[model samples]
Target: MAWHDRAPDSFTATLWDGIGDVWAEIRAHPFLTGLKDGTLDHRAFVFYVIQDAHYLREYARALAVCGARANDVAGIRMFCEHAAGAIAVERELHESFFADFGLSEADVAATPMAPTNVAYTSYLLSAAYGGSYAEAVGAVLPCYWIYAEVGRELLAAGSPDSRYQRWIDTYGGEEFAEVVSQVLDAADAVGPSLSEADRAAAAHRFTTTSRYEWMFWEMGLRRETWPV
Candidate 1:
């Protein structure tokens, strides 16, 4: 069977279809499994949240770059909203988790970026600065798409821990799903007009970022730190 058997006919869908193994790996990742069952360590969860806070700051900047480069008013406005929402709304979620986890602002600020976090955000920033609009969108899409999917899956399985449940509900709720849908719509609008080379680049960005998504979860599970 195809990876994205039910996916609609669009570049994002095609990119997703081509990355079956990566998606499966993400779904089966120990971090996600532990999260689903509420068996994950609190320290590990805290580490994940800290690293994610760092990631979101850079992600928001990349989104702003995308907005600045967008050709259409709607695309520009959509990306601007997304950029603001990432910082305003998602960062607020992180702040709430920080309080629950006993993580101070200084603690999060002092947290060094793991190798994987650095690589993932660097790739995104590079794409945003150097690639076309489609490529930028593709690079960022996996973050939203994967989290939304994982959130729904974990929520359905039911977390025994309220902390874990809160995290799950934030991403799994209808509001976040709508955000993902808006992003998908933006990608589809730009996809059909992309040149063949641009399309290929966008697919590569999508696939590469999807791998990073899995690595991100693994980084969290390990509470990854700089090896040096």
Candidate 2:
């Protein structure tokens, strides 16, 4: 009856299914729902983009770390390419949005990390530095998997806002889906060999990051900032 009790052959599938409720919450979150409906505040969306630009810098570094630590050359190359591709996407996407939002290079550099952004990126960096290859992959998987899923869902439902539609199409497109598949395959490769304890640890990483994914949307909706 519990979520994780359902049998799945692949550990990645199992981990994903176990977090069904979390995914549901994400899909229904007002931030995302508003985006779908073209009702979300423009300022909030801009804030999300600015914070995401900040997050992607650290995320690329984390990917590079994972690539360096991978045992197989193919895994190393895949991760490294993903890392580079992530940066390239970040630059292109954010720059495209900058004129729309009147955001300059200095403005982006001056923006502080929101509380959730700090927490999410810090957790990922620590995981990459301290955890095994399996755990590192787990920690990073949700960003790819969740975004891809959300992108596809948004595309299907259709966004009235061109900006929102562009965001959705980028992740929902074939190229990004291929990247997500590669990451999933990489996780699957390392997962089977993990000890039970390590596997559980990896699942925990996946679940925690998934929660952060939800909080990230919430953070954007609120335009969250530190109180102190």
For each candidate in turn, the TM-score is: 0.95, 0.95
Report the lDDT tens digits of candidate 2 across residue range 63-169. Answer: 99999999799989998998998889757997899888888989999999999999999999999999988889999999999998898888888899999888888
- Give the CA lDDT, 0 to 100, for residue 31 in model 2: 92
Q: Rate the local accuracy (lDDT) of all candidates.
A: 0.88, 0.89
In model 1, residue pairs whose N, Cα or C atoms come closer than 3 Å (at least 3 residues apart or on different chains), thus clashing, are none
Top-lDDT structure, candidate number: 2
Candidate 2, superposed: residue stretches over 4 Å from native:
1-7
- Per-residue lDDT tens digits of candidate 1, residues 1-228? 122232477777887888889989999998888888888998899999999999999999999998998888988998899999999998999999999878799988988999999999999999999988888888998998888888888878888888888899998888888888878877877888988998999999999999999999899999888877
